[model samples]
Target: MMSGRGTEAVADAVRRAFVNGMGEPVAVSTRRLSPAEADQLLPPGSEGLTVVVPEDDVLGALLPGITVTGAVVVADETGARLFFTSVPVGGQHELVAAGIRAATAELAAEVSRLRTEAAVVDALHSVGRQLTAQLDIDRIVQDATDAATKATGAAFGAFFYNLVDELGESYTLYTLSGVAREAFAGFPMPRNTDVFAPTFDGQGTVRSGDITADPRFGRNEPYHGMPAGHLPVRSYLAVSVVSPTSGDVLGGFFFGHPGTGRFTERHEYVAEGIAGYAAIALDNARLFDRERHLVGQLSRSMLPVVPEIPGLDIVTRYLPAATGSKIGGDWFDVIRLRSGGTAFVIGDVVGHGVTAATVMGQVRTAIRSYAQLELPPADLLREVSELAGALFDPSFVTCFYAVHEPDGHTLTYGNAGHLPAVLVRPDGAIEEIGEALSQPLGVGSKFAERQTVFEPGTDLLLYTDGLVESRTRDLTLGIRWLLSGLPALREAPDVGAACDELITGLTGGRHDDDIALIHVRHRAGT
Candidate 1:
């Protein structure tokens, strides 16, 4: 006699059997009930298998008997058995009964296998999603560690990134999970050994039930044991994150468990899939870094180094955006004009990266060429604007150009869709010059020139919009902040120190857009 739950369990087992064996859905019932009771409990068109009395009229001999309705009855010394299947057949009854029994046994094993495979697939998909969600290398490694540990049912997991220093020597950064930071604090990073070599070198996957038992485990000299507080590990599985395009190994995923044979072949496959996703993430990060490096180099090369001018102390600074922000097109130059004046220019090309940098280079060259003609500020602005429009077609630029005359004690400057240049007076009063601006260059916009008395013992400051523009603050507020902070900056010993202090005050030393600043202090005596 079986309880109600036991009967349902048997029914589920038989249904699985029917589907796996016959490729069809069939109802099965097992309970301790007579024919009349089973008919009452079972639904119409469903089959019921129940225990029955051998003395019942349907089976006089108390041996196994098959009914026309696909019900089979068998009598053993302990009790009578009944099996109900959907289809009724006219084959050898004993052979059919034997086949059904065999299928039920096979169903149990197949179901277990299917469940394991499904788990592996789900784990792979989960890790893939995590890996693709972001490109930060540290976060990617941490996520990989978590996913690998969970997928393999390991006690601990770690990811190691192979990195090269500026000196071209190789080192690694590690992200760990299922372990204490304190445990690793006192321990040295693991080196390449017989056990870790396969994955580290990209030779193949390594799955070991007991790493210490392997004969070649510690072939390297001085086989120091694991750290004292390190978690015990008997099972080990490692997979290498290898770039498919370059075939270079970027990193490795390593898992460990205290119990031997904790990881299986299925776990290895799941780890492999995780490694593939991580490899892609690493490749993307590398490409982004490479592009930023190249753009930084190009933009820096285009900026003119400050030249020593008589009676003028000039200082310049260029700050690129923080990581993850696009490289911008801000530039500054200090050129000795053919008229024996110092030309100070700051401009921002209206985009980012290689294209913006290229356009900026062209405009700077045009401005320098026009300045060499010793034209007045307004005429120079007009010529450079026209040149930028013709050369950089759709891209526009905002510029402020000024030339300081040493003998005349006057500053001649012009603006084209740019921020105002700030002049700090000797009395700590601030004035904004070049306020009358026109449209930016590359649009054939008109420009105007303005002259102001650049009094002795005063300072001049010119910068791109990046120094005064942010999402939360308008240009007006940024300018106000700069003006309010000028009194304190006027006492700085030199233009270089003043520029550094001004940047720190205005931008807090970090900017979303690139910043270019040119500062000049005029003295009464050279």
Candidate 2:
């Protein structure tokens, strides 16, 4: 009658009958099956209990084990019912018949009992389906525990788990059911002390008919807090909650009722399956949290604080891509020039994560190293282009470098496949330093790069593409927005302050892409 949910129903019925018989002599139950199902379970007198009416001629031919001692036949077309007192015979016939009758009835009842169980399983399935559809763990456990208690007729059902600290040596009590008692969630079960401890310890499984009856489960001094044999208690069962990777005993399951002989092996199997799923859910959540922490750590390590220069102001900020996974390729640097000036540089490597950020660091460090020995903006960028191509992928990076000098107007700068930085002037003028033409670094360009001296207090801004290039907008518009913001930035007290103002003005609230900005100011008179 139970179309699905496997053969648990029939097996459970046999177990229930045995438990019932312990209280009374002849507790009987029947499980019905289709002709096909009956063949699989009963299998034609395999248990030697198939009864059939034959012509009285064949009664004596059935072997003395099945012969009738006395009979009065009432015959019909379908069959015959004869009044007969089976003669006493040996070979444990009394015990065998009683066992067969109990087994057969239990199997017969299973067909119906399973039909009811099938309904409950179907309901549980529906709950699982709903919870899984939304991918919500708390809701899934909540619905599953409630549905299971109602379906199995348990006096109470609750969930228990362990919150392991990273050290792997300590754990706190954790649970997820709607139990009213504080002890339900506050009580910590030791990984080595529960009925499930042996299972977790040996990586095996365990079930108890009564907690007080089993040596492994009953005599545990640690379980004194549990009311297993107390006035309100009866039987209990538990399954090992374990780690999928380490097989560590995270915790155990607990189920009990006031009825004697309430827990059985089949119940143990069901609880184990539920606990296994809960373990997987808890594992997934833990992994998610760990990954987030790692990403944050890596991102911070990728951009240490900018090095301090004796007299020149050097400031750099790296904002990782907001919408992307927690890593990006934006980078910047300030190098003190041998000629008593400083090189303000900004560029972006074209990717994200450890790889992109790594390449960005190399490029940033390489620029500073080469800057210490060069002065002409165009020449320094050329050295960078050739060295980068030699050391990295030919198409790896886009960059811009600007060298600032004492003359308010004598600034030297060039671009190699980098966005021309936004220039904010002392008069509140905003303009992108126009690069007439230059190939992006690593792309090999022959068009000679150029440099120009400009006005005093010129704040140059640099950044990666994540700033202006949303899926809906053009990249050039982002550049132009930075260009427009320059007028306000120019009025800021210093280069460091202007960079902050420019970022807020351009990104609205947050920049989706990595944003690296550097500002350079000129002293009016030497």
Candidate 3:
């Protein structure tokens, strides 16, 4: 393909040369091709021949001594060549050709340098985005290793790092790219050898065109250099990943190729850039893991263990959200009241993370404190709501409080913007209780208590929104699903099994929100 201002003239010149050389008639067609189109067809540094005429005439006008008419520039994979359309009479062409070739070579070298720099910058940006999106340390290192291997044209790459467990014990871990884990399964962790120590110790980057020739090679005991059954490596590069915040070496990236002199200075630069990104990503993941662990411990510590009450069976379950920090505000408690009644409580504060969990703990404690006063369910909820409004700002909470009287035949309850409770009778009839429904706590809505005769052999199920609400199912549909499964609870061996069955059916064993469940059953002979 040909492109430029004088493509038609060049096509004519080519046809004339072809006819004069071959002495035969040949057909030649010309079409306009944009410079952009030509560049697409033939990318930079591509192999092939290209010829063009100088588009600028100011150069010739500035040089008065040489009256240049037309000049053509020819380029190939090797380098570029310049030729004049007409030679001066008795002029030696050899010297001029040599000078033009030297100038073209220098220009080509500069263009190649710029292209390499541009490519490295683009690769670093892409690797940074991939690393930042991952919160898992293993994934971050594997991705960084893969990107560095490709950028450096290495046959294999590995990232070796350190991790600390809960007991404060440090251990080593490694991730490999372009090779399977089995390849290194039989080998022990790399030692602090003369050649490998610099990278692991964070002294400086080590790059070798032929590592075996280095003075540090073969200086260690037991096999001297690479161990037996190791992948061949003549070209090697290593860079330490140092944490920017702590100024400690997190890990090191190593790349290798079997061919001699496969790596260059540019490859070392690219590997270092990827190592920097990997360090930041790994640090963020470690911080997230620590926070998640602390939040989980706090949430578990706040849940109350049910006490053994005569003639009553109580079973409870609490599951945190599946994503993010994996902790939230959902909580459950079974409080033995002063009047010999039992208060079953479940509440969910809005949002998640450490803040939501702390709020939940405070609300749960307040409810337990008020239960000691022997107050009714409605009065108890009113007191908690007033406390919640004063303590929690711009955050709301949903709760349900129910009291089963000492006689085991009277049930009083109050709901504050929470899901309605489900009751299954002895004969398998289902009833949904929502008469005491009101706005959530901190919303300035009054609570009205409701009462029902708690018959023997009856089961009451109370749960947070997570049990029946998800991205795929709305509250209305979720409630319908819950009601459909209630009649079957009677067939369950015990209340605990019934709670598990209901959760499995509604959430399919996977839920995105925090769940709190309280199942209570009154025995027939009580």
Candidate 4:
């Protein structure tokens, strides 16, 4: 009995009832205790009659050597301090005490079950988001494998997928989680056996609590069950990933555990959901890869091969953007004029992808056609700009065109909203010749042409904006860095080595945008 302000009558009635029911002498005692102290007498999930006999001096003074059995804890509005102890054996008190403990244990188990369900739901939501956010096939597959293996409580998991090469040859690849790749290096690719056929054919999910005991486990040839060095597996689960759009089987997720009866219905449901997400992600990645391949090929075919002109050393480099597979509009060309001179051209078209690359091709062809007319730099740009305004949107392209005369001394160039070309004189003097700057093609009516006399051993560099613009450095600072580094090119063994060194030093070999570089060195003895 718990000591409270007005529970004495209730305690006395309960004591009398217990004594009459048991037909034995019973003595009841009351004590005031906090909730924490009372919990120790009857803890959560405690099942059945928990009897504590009295051996202390205080309780023994009232009834010497009393067998204090039939202990019960009752919780009410006040707290859980209503404790009762009887001195009888086998009666109504024992039945009542046992009922309360049994109910508490059941309630505790229910709460734990609900918490586990909520956690699994949350984890599945996170996994779905992670799978849908990626477009890389390798990354998406690996992430899906790792997440599903953790959710299913598997000792190790593997995702076996199919890939088609450029020559249309199909091959199988696998990603592993929770185990080293060397663990399965000696094993051959899984065949469509009795156990694996259902998963690979996308029939349905297969889950076995004890896979070794399953009838479909030992029907394959060569290795009837598992190979000698294979990891021990008693529980197995597998799900096939099928594309939602094409209905094609993309891959299968296989999970295993060394302990028996490790997976459940809930594990099967979660694995199926993960397989759905992986299928969609893999489909998107494969489509993206194909499109990128075609666009890259088209962009590369439009670039020209630098001609080997006598008395002039020319080297050019074109690098696609490093971030994505989208093609850019940066291009460079070296045209040998019929009059024994050389024409150098570099340009950039706005935007990216197929549209930008198409515009670049048109602009490059227009410039080459106008250059063959023997027009001055200004006249050639004017003709190209007029054609751009009629064919494309306003200010869509920026270009720089320079023509070196037959004497290999006079250089005439036109700048149409392009970066200034750097000229390195024989004396190591640097000069930026951008006096003919004008609006980009399709925006300006008149173009300006600038003329300069190049002495022997002079070096000229023309490049697109990608070389002097980046996320970390502005155009001005990048240009300054380029100017400061140009003097070192004088010591380079050849023009090709010098061009490679310049690009590597400026972008640190990891640039995000496309780069088109042209290095023209007037021979020292010419």
Candidate 5:
């Protein structure tokens, strides 16, 4: 430690020589140091600079340690106070004293430079946070424009996005802070000519004191000069917003000042940073929208449309978990069996996303293939479970399958580690069918089917566990809630209305898991 301190001592010795030849060294705190405090920092005859770098202050690379020598000085203090030392020395002591004052002035300038850099860093961080926090593209663009205008001290700021059409290209301008929106409202977008060429074509950042005087002045059609109502522009800084991943020019940020020489190189740099962030934000938003569209298409394509069955009203609804892309492995099917019995199936796979969806598709296909064999509920579960175990060994899934036979007035149902189905009788009584079941698919467990007689107007509900399970309650309580909630559903006029009521009551549109529900109301015939 002393060795390092010794180096600082040597550097300080040289700095003092260049700073001044003083009678004695003085200690000065950037904050609260007095001339009398000079005695404490150094001996009476000692000469050096005492710079106070606050303990909490962050210095990038200017100072590596507290001990240094010569022009650059660093030292320590108790609690919040930190001071550095610098001593001035030379043979021309009388003349050196006058020069010492200039040394202090230079040090003050250096301190100001450091502070400016720190402020820029803090401002950039703030802009990044505010930009990514909102997903709305328009809002993000506006905020970025505002931040750039203020940070660069521009009179006005605007972000331009180009939209191509069969009729040629069009531009959308989002302006802020400086000029009134009405000024540009009546004027058509400026053509990519003259001074605006570099920004619109995404060449790079362009900084100019007086854009009108440039050699590559206006040369485009539609307008030869600035429109009557256009905001006066003398100084300008433009940065193109280019997507990092796609390399497509999304837009450009343009800042203008009415006074000449109002902008500098630093302003160009700040504007460029904002433009980069804006490009990223736009890409993220557009990607999310596209994904959501694809997810919606995939969801719609995967679930088979309910078939029309005589003497029965069937309705199905599938709601995915309310997170991410809201895509999960919840599905429902209504197939007319070979024997004219309507088979109702609703299942939930073990996970979410494309993988889970793919698994669900496979299982549904397997079930459909086996349905042709006319196997009973128990036999169907066994075959599907075996198939699932072979296909998805590590992961398992829950499913509820039931068949409604209008001829026998019976409902035969089976459960494979899935929630029990809710049966609402015409007499206002409720029952949970097949409460007991074997292991889920992929577990290779034996299964059993249960049968129940149903009268016309009776409602049978087959659902995935997402409807009856919640973050706060267990399976038993969820079952009880379902049992109680069915009465409200029974009053609905049709199966579709009843399904809607069940979903609205059970999930309230905020489920942590995907839900698949099948509701069938036996018409008054049997």
Candidate 6:
């Protein structure tokens, strides 16, 4: 509060301080104070800031609140008006001003921390969502980079580590952000790259407020990809990027620019935190990529590797999901059941990932065991269902189990809520068999119903939902498409070729799901 007489002068000083945005809805608001009731609002004091408006004129008024040093407002019939708050002691706004700054920094830090925590949690959820999707390296890299950059408030950022080329020599570089490409999109690789200095190798994180002042500059480390004297950087912070699981420093996370304030120790800590998440995500992505490559190799490894059955012309093709991921449920197997006949099964686990694939493997084994017993189709299905229930992998699965008797020239089978298989006969005729479906292998009812028989020389096919469940379409159209596409597959003698054509036509050349096909022709004599 100020004396009404000095209200005008005091108010002017306040305007330059805190209450600068008083009339405008505050970006931040303080406790309310009434300028007219200055005396009531002010604490007991001598005559620090006082003013008094005599009657309707600018008479007298006094204000003493360290929290609000001064004010600025339009003077009226009542004493004078007030607006902002000024400093104190050393300056017009010393004590109060310092307090305001400190409060602001603290608040900003708190908000930033909360946001960082949220980013990490959100990233964790993202990982859960992708566990089944088996997200690839590029996507994980981009996502992790984006989150880190956002947390650090950088223009852009990324994760970089060491990777081996064909020759197996480990090469290190910035690999996350599109920085390297954007910086040198058309340029060829440098013959001898040594921009990065030797000291930077083991120093987990190296930040320079003023690079010119740092001794590392003399060593010629790749700090910002430029000559030390010409570098447009005033400050920098770099942290070592590491393999989260192995604790091996891979690359680093860096923040810099020409800003005067530059980054502080707190900023370095924040950057390091950002790097921690990026490192873990990136490392996992690397491992996942390796695993997928192995899956691809293994998936094709033993399929026909054991040499086809002596009398059967068997062709198997496993088309993985087109989503750039391989964690899928679709599976196919051709086994020699203990009974004279051969059994074929196409199944899809309820979900994907190590879990779904594991479940599929289990179902495959159980189905094989039941088929070997030479029991009725329905009984085999029921046995499989019971086993699935016993080993129910939380994620349910669906399957089509078929045992072919070439001797009798008939195929007996049952459907456990799996997609109906297409059967193309020798005379270019086709039949979609096994219409009846019981509960899926691992869910709902305890067991599925019985099996049906398909005439000899009839082609049978089974696949996962990802095959026909399009973004805007249902399985009805998918089945119809398969039914209509049978004509084209009729003349294709090679089972593999025929399957390739059928899949391409029915799926419009894009398969969002995993497709597993098994084809066997009945011999003239069994």
Q: Residue 192 deviation, candidate 3, in Å? A: 1.4
Worst 10 residues of 5 by lDDT: 72-81
* Candidate 2 residue lDDT tens string, 30-81: 3233344333323243322232222444445432465453322222122222
CA shift at 492, candidate 1, in angstroms?
3.8
lDDT of each: 0.74, 0.57, 0.78, 0.80, 0.71, 0.58
Clashes of each: 0, 13, 0, 1, 19, 46
TM-score of 2: 0.55
Of the pair 2 and 3, which is ahead by lDDT?
Answer: 3
Give the per-residue lDDT digits (tens) of candidate 4, residues 248-294. Answer: 89889999999999999999989998999999899888888887787
The lDDT leader among the candidates is 4
Error of 6 at 502 (Å): 5.9
- TM-score for each predicted model, relative to the true structure: 0.73, 0.55, 0.79, 0.79, 0.74, 0.56
lDDT of 6 by residue, 1-526 (tens): 4336544444443444443323332122122335535444432331323322112222223333334434323333343344433333123333443444454456546766787678766755554444324345556555555555555555445455566654668875554442444543443332222323321364556666676566645443343355434325557656666666887765656554665446666566666665666566667767766766666765565243223554566777787666444567678877775556777778888655677777777777777677667876678777777777787646667778777775556677778778777777767667777665666765645434434454555556666676667766688987777678666665566667877877877777667677777766553333
| Stretches > 4 Å off in candidate 3 | 1-50, 53-112, 353-355, 471-473, 484-511, 523-525
lDDT score for residue 66 of model 4: 53
Candidate 3: residue 525 Cα off by (Å): 4.1
lDDT of 4 at 507: 87
> Higher-lDDT candidate among 1 and 2?
1
